[model samples]
Target: MPDYSLLARQLKALLDTRDWLTNSAQTSAFLMQEIPDLNWAGFYLQRSSEQLTLGPFQGKPACNPIPFSKGVCGAAARTRQTQRIDDVHAVADHIACDSASESELVVPILDTNGALWGVLDLDSPRKARFSEADQAGIEALVEIFCQASDLD
Candidate 1:
């Protein structure tokens, strides 16, 4: 299990006064380095109510401009909730941005005003790589991220 408290503290300290781009880049790198069993870690900003444009990510090239009606990221955005899938292949609507990714966790990002912003997406090569604790931890980190940057 990862130490989310430490990660949260470190994330806050690292991104104290950075811009969105810098923070996004660092956040992806941070997740990639800090989290284990992760094949992909990144953010997808909501370009529109129905579109999610790919942001900073550490992994193979990803599918850009995903709609809010498709994939895990879309499901999270559409529902404004976290979508943690144990097996990507098992989900009929799963979009294979990376075929090697067996599991995925997507957390919808809500700005300080509680408006839908984007999502923090993580994928693993192992099935069921995430637990409920991970979902809570990642949600906390995303909260920190939202607090640090002003996303509109």
Candidate 2:
């Protein structure tokens, strides 16, 4: 595992602003650059109660307007929980934005009041790419991100 402590500090430095738009872009880039085996790193904003719109990302083109009833991202958002899937292909509702992606980790982005802001999604071409430690670390990083931004 990469030094999440170090990465946290680095992300703190990189944010440099309270704007969610700017910070989201930077966070996506930071994760893609720092984490290994990642094919996609990005955000999916909860545009409505029913679906998510694509946000800043570093990877190939992605699927848009993901509903709360479908895919790993949807599961995370719907349950307000982190989702770590070992094999995305096994998921019947898995949205194949990138056929190369075999694994996924999604963390729900909620405010201090527990309002649904969005979700941070990471995709890897390798199966079982995200471990327990990775989920904890990335969740921590997402917490940091929410703290440093004005998500309202």
Candidate 3:
């Protein structure tokens, strides 16, 4: 029973006057604190032509650069869609940067032109930590982040 409206407002306000890169860091911090049962919360950005570079994140250090066609982050970037994994063990090509993470959710952040820019990734130690409601709420937050922050 998370207050999505309040969360969205906070994210929007934080990003309204901040650069995307800077604001993304703030957003990750916010989510890491707000969300319960999460072991990791962060952003993975498309730095080069076909690479997903690690961005500001909360939790342990993660894999530096994830390829565009590998792992959950890559699948989200390649498909430009949200990836909700209830069980990380079941996901093929799963990256075990953190052995304690049992579940993961990845939401792709798109620019106004619908270009793949980055992704917001969340990991939980509990299996099936994310629900449909969580997905919708996070997706809404992503939209707000896109609208408020400068993609350039």
Candidate 4:
């Protein structure tokens, strides 16, 4: 189990006095350091109505400008929901930017007006790496980031 409360606190504190772009990099680094079994941690910004451009991230290189009709990241952004995929291979139209990624989690960032701002994406090499509790916790952390930064 992870200390979600402490993680949220740290994220909030980190974003309390920094620009979103600066904090975006820090958020990725923070999650990469704090979370276990994570191969990638990052963000995608809404560059258009149905397009997501890659933002700050940690891990190997990834796909840029993922369409809304594409993979897990697209699905999350399109539906404005969290897509916690336990197995990347089983999903249809799954984009394998990193062959080492076996599982993925994507959380869409919705602003105060309930509009899509972007997404927080995490990838892991192990199957079934993310749990519902992990999803809830990360959602909270992303919420803090969205609230504190210029991401909205």
TM-score of each: 0.96, 0.98, 0.95, 0.95
What clash count goes with each model? 0, 0, 0, 0
Candidate achieving the largest lDDT: 2
Model 2: per-residue Cα lDDT over 1-152, one tens digit each: 88999999999999999999999999999999999999999999998886999999999999999999999999999999999999999999999999999999999998768889999999999999999999999999998899999999
For model 2, which pairs clash? Answer: none
lDDT of each prediction vs. the true structure? 0.92, 0.96, 0.89, 0.91
lDDT of 1 at 128: 99
- Is candidate 2 or 4 superior in TM-score? 2
lDDT of 3 by residue, 1-152 (tens): 68899898887777756478778888889999998999899999987977899999999999979987888988999998899999999988999899999999999988777788889999999999999999999999888878778785
Which residue pairs in candidate 3 have backbone atoms (N, alpha carbon, C) closer than 3 angstroms, thus clashing? Answer: none
Off by over 4 Å in 3: none
Candidate 4: segments with Cα more than 4 A from true spot: none
Model 1 local distance difference test score = 0.92
Clashing pairs in 1: none
